[model samples]
Target: MSVPSGLPQDTPVAGGEQRVLRFSIAATAVVAALGIVFGLMSGSYAIVFDGIYSLADGATSLVALLVVNLIAGYNASGSQNRRLAEKFTMGFWHLEPMVLGATGLLLSGAAVYAFINAIGSFLTGGRPLQFGQAIVYAIATVLISLGMAWYGRRANRHLRSELVAMDIRGWLMSAAITAALLVAFIVGLAIQGTSLEWMSPYVDPAVLALVCLVIFPIPLGVVRRALEEILLVTPTALKQHVDAVAQAVVERHGFLSHRAYVAKVGRGRQIELYFIAPAGWPARTLEEWDALRDEIGEAIGDDSPDRWLTIAFTTDREWAE
Candidate 1:
């Protein structure tokens, strides 16, 4: 006998998460435009790179927003789109990891490309930059990026959304990059008329290379996590919890043995428990079995829409296995 809990129809989308992402996208567009225009005016490849990064980030964020909407809409009760539901019966949880992985890869690739350009410029004795224009751009970009990061973080305190969290990290990374550029520009300006004037041309490339080095490895963590989810890796903590619950149930009911399986995909938890009843044990009614499944579910806790739980009982070991 098997008892399956009611599967969630709608994965609720936090209103604040959508608002945060929309605001982030808007802010990214403005910052990206500013970065490109200022980079060209100042003849700074570093600023150009910053703009390109913002553009890539914005593009990925747009994709994330769409996925969020799709996940929220697809399994909703009374949804009119039967074709959509039929095509994606498992819901859109899988898309979350894909978006996260893509975002990490895109950002990392941009950093690598910028690093290469910075190195080439450095080797060629670097290029001249209008320090005044670069300075102004960096200061403004830093302020805006910091404000957005703070806002995203604050919103996520309640939202706890991965998309919003990733966007927050992007804003913080941008702020750090621009802040570094600001400092480098100041130094470059200060040394313009001094004995160190020869170093002015190299300043922009040097700072760009340094910033790239710092940021290139930052997204690897996100990529790793996404990969784990995509592969449906069994989460250790969840697996352990499921085992403990199954063990307690078996001991309490004097069952022969039990088997538990658990895997996490994105924010969704999938758990299955099988209990092996001894041979010649008295059979319980379906209602009694369902009540036992309910007890097991409550013991496992985390009764959320994202959880998919299945419990089974069988007299034959083969069936439990």
Candidate 2:
């Protein structure tokens, strides 16, 4: 959606570029279901674990989808004024990443469990694994990984969506894991009659576990960051940026002192900012008010060290003197 008007006191801003997140949501959901089905059908433990993690990814994707809709101005049929009224009531889209982050943590924990079982298998000689299944799984893994990497980066290009970029990394890691499984499985099968049967099976789970341990951190970090925002925790640098932007308007444009506080919403290249403006900034008349709005948009314009953004500006008529 186009950026919202640059007023914060009363208006709401939309955020999060649609390309990166929407693609991810659809892709992950499909892959999650595929992984679950294939894993269960083939009786592949590693694949089963992959399915579980994929399901978690699906959950996050669903969240991203919702957040994207919110930011993209998803609304029921209505006129501009009616749509704006709804927008004003809903505020901005800020909770998408929170859902993603939490889901990532759940996947990480599950990966840990998968990892432990892999190591534990040294005693049981590892479980019987289908070498052919490894190939199929790997193929799917690579396709999904490449697709995600492409879209995730594409999203970053358009909206600077680090979350989407993060998704790319996750998918790449999954592909790598599957590739390792395929290679190891094939090699072990070749040497099965000799001295590598035990080793072959062991290798698959060991590698899977190792991959899980390595890949799990990505989502965990995402989750932690998501929680911070969801819980009203603000980063020092972000707080500084908000404060700086607001203070600059006051100092340069003669806005009321300490009269505005701005907070950034959304993730990635798309940012939505909410701020207060002094009522007495020569905006007494209707035309002056409209001019003030234009001034705010130009001042904070999507050029505030951001590629895509929505900065909502609102006059503090009731509070500011």
Winner by TM-score: 1
Score every model by TM-score: 0.94, 0.70
Off by over 4 Å in 2: 1-43, 74-76, 79-88, 235-256, 267-297, 303-321
Which pairs of residues collide in candidate 1?
none
**lDDT scores for all predictions?**
0.87, 0.61
Please give the lDDT score for candidate 1: 0.87
Clashes of each: 0, 12
Model 2: worst 10 consecutive residues (lDDT sum)? 5-14
- Expressed as tens digits, the lDDT of each residue in 160-210 for candidate 1 is 888899999999999999999999999999999899999999999999999
True-vs-predicted CA distance for residue 265, candidate 2, Å? 3.1
Q: Every model's Cα RMSD, please?
A: 2.0, 6.2
- Report the alpha-carbon TM-score of model 1 versus the true structure: 0.94
lDDT of 1 at 190: 95
Cα misplacement distance, residue 266 of candidate 2 (Å): 2.1
